[model samples]
Target chain A: MNPSDDAGRSGVSRRSVLGGGAAVAVAVPLAAGGAQAAPAAEAASVEPVTVKVTVNGEPVTVRVDPRVTLLDTLREELALTGTKKGCDRGQCGACTVHVDGRRVLSCLTLAVTVDKREVTTIEGLARGDRLHPMQQAFIERDGLQCGFCTPGQVMSAVGMVQEGHARSDDEIRERMSGNICRCGCYPSIVAAISDAQKVMR
Target chain B: MRAYTFTQPRAVREAVTQAGTDTAFLAGGTTLVDLMKLDVMTPARVVDINRLPLRGIKLDRDGLHIGALERMSDVAADRNVRRDYPMIAQALQLSASAQLRNMASIGGNLLQRTRCGYFRDVSTPCNKREPGTGCAALTGINRTHAILGTSDACVATHPSDLAVALVALGTHVHLVSGRGTRTVPLDGFYALPGSTPDVENVLRPGELITGITVPRSMWAANSVYLKIRDRQSYEFALTSAAVAIEWRGRTIRSARIAAGGVGTKPWRLPAVERALTGRPATPDVFESAVRTAADGARPLPHNGFKPALLRRTLVRALTVLAESR
Candidate 1:
């Protein structure tokens, strides 16, 4: 979660992910009918599972708890936090990531099951300092409110655009129904993704 | 959440051997992992059977054999499944979110647990979870309870949309146990909630579902899956039906219809199928067929709207089929 390495250029300060409510909520009650009263370290005692993931363009090996979700591993272990943790119950699209180039909810997926498979997180979407076109559109259209759910939204939008799925506003709405925005920022979000889709096409 | 042991078994024999000792088989882990995270299922050992080559999709002499490990997404996109068995493909595609469909397997989908609030809670007294504990779903906040298969003990409906379509297809299941291999009609695999709601399936100890065998049929080519719920997507069916038809020129030769979100198991409507066979494909035929299909269907206090909704969905589905025919 330390963004000190590339903060200045992205204009995202370390304070966004550290020493704030954003960092605190990650450890609080995860969701309704969910446990928010534990630490990620406590989950480590369960089992030290080792799995090799062919992530994006590279193969990376990590040891984690057997209970660790793919979403948690991306954010906590690899610092690939572009996959958001909206509802964390597979109900929301904020945790959307790609497994072998197909969209999947990272929160509902287990790291153990993704072994030796190609996983694309939001972190790998951009080429070096170049922003992913979808990310650029979000900025251009102001497609965010609190920004907690932006990363997951951006990742999902990237998947839809790359797949040529957003043929119309209705199609976009149906495809994006999996993700929810409490701030009612869907209009702008859809606009941003649609604009990006035009460019990607 | 106690710790559990994990074993990756590459063969069926190795998995069956471990299944004898309180082990749960892991396929896609979509539903199982969610339940486990909620502390609903705490198995002592988990047998990861993904290494086995059970992810098959093919058409042969006997029928279609779909491997147990085949993901829902793969099945939905399969050429044969889409072209021939439209109901199966549409049902699989209509379930859950895109990510879930990608991770959920056919076998796992068939065996998914009920989405009942009581069954999911560790603190709740569910007959399915702990036999003789009594069901809280009987009269307590039973909005999503089943009406077709209800006893005083339980009322929760089975939660797979794809299984309903498979039932309409008259699919048979292949199981591999330590003793040997055997096949059972999918309709008979699930048991009613009469006295032992806990024993939901007839699966013997150490028996693993190998694949699904859907017999070759002329009806498969003209099929549809219709799901109706509170929301447009990612929600369980309120009253859904899977329809497949065989046509003799302008007349319907045979029909396969089943209901979901309204039964203890995926319910095959014999009455409806009987009505459709040998009748000319028409709007009147569709209406009468749906009426007979749900005849004598009992509705609970909350789910009474389903019988009517089911009929409408069937009419709409049959009309679609008629046009296509």
Candidate 2:
């Protein structure tokens, strides 16, 4: 059976859906298990562009389908799952990461666009065992419950402080509005950011 | 998202030349990528124009020239935009979230599609998304549908707060294509949803927006953008007013006003502007002038409150502008 037929039923084919770095990990196992194998003709049809990106101070080269997003590349490809994907759409800030020193929704950022740019994920914040001020502040303030949104919240707070918008509690709440803590940890999150701001400065 | 070949053009000329009927110029990727994932927009060729040098904010003797590729947050934070064009700055600040504002470009923000639920869901019928497909929002849940500019075909509102401020300040959009360059007033750039609801803008296929110019004026410095939404932040407006007033002594010399979340396009209110000109800047004048806000408004079943809301929002904006100065 052609993979396109599966796409006809599901609106997306496995061959076309494997744009994330996790594609290699997921595809090889399935192929070895003899579950399904993408035909060489279908595989050769896609043109993967090579991109040289600096992620977390490490220089890396990745060849990805143009459709792959930065969030998928980090989580699935590079296995840097520290940056969580809450909503694949840009609505949720769980996929937030710093591209070129600015906080942006990695889910909406195409991997090709980040070529030759510096991307700092949540994993990059700590130096060795010493946590970034924001990370330590979140722990002290009990800023997280389930901690799914912690990485994005911390990353966004760091960027927000660097942008000089985290001056007051009200301002911190307004600036940190993007990262939604579904566990209702907004007060703690705001407190954490406020605490981190002084130390980070 | 659909599979498509992507190209990064170093020059604007090369980017324009690469454009075709089935090609899309990617910027920001907020609206385009979101829509593409829903299969609403399926372009065969995707052109990444991020590498182009269209990112700058310059003010000359003419006016404020904002490059098309400038990010929303960067433009909002620019000294000139914050100091001279407060309405533009406030609009950008109030739109989306911090993350989106950082990623979204000014050029793509103007061309963002409507927030109509019917248009977003491919399962539903939207004349704007698919022409000849009957509009589900016409008789469905349309509490957020447009009231000022409603046609039988579509009733979706234009979702840009910045465009409303830009239109009120008399901004001109700079466009460039393989054919050449031409400038169009931002007010006239958007097409009304009449017979062809699918055709949103006047851009010819492959045409690109280079920059926008807002003519410097004393009134713009006193401008204010007042948006009333269900939520206090991170939501599209139920009714929004962008008002700029030029005061001469106690009376108004000139007034520039535009409304959002009530029309198919950023609506300039010349009638309201006429009511304020040469009149004393008072609460009475603002209330009476704002009454004409819903003069020709055609309200749907659920959106009957918009006209009243538009009037109140405009009055509040005018009052705020009057009081602030």
Instruction: Find the candidate with the highest TM-score and give its number.
Output: 2
Task: Encode model 1's per-residue lDDT on B17-107: one tens digit a residue.
Answer: 8786566788878787778777777777778888988978998867788999999978887888898888999998788876677678888
Tens-digit lDDT track of model 2 for B208-238: 9999999989798899999999987788999
Could you tell me the lDDT of residue B43 within candidate 1?
75
For model 2 the TM-score comes to 0.92
Task: Count clashing pairs, candidate 1.
Answer: 2
Clashing residue pairs in candidate 1, if any?
A: A29-A36, A104-B99
TM-scores of all predicted structures: 0.89, 0.92
Candidate 2: tens digits of C-alpha lDDT, residues A54-110: 888888777877777788777667777889888777887998999999999998888
Q: State how far residue A70 of model 1 sits from its true place (Å).
A: 2.0
Cα-based lDDT at residue B57, candidate 1 = 97
Candidate 2's docking class is acceptable
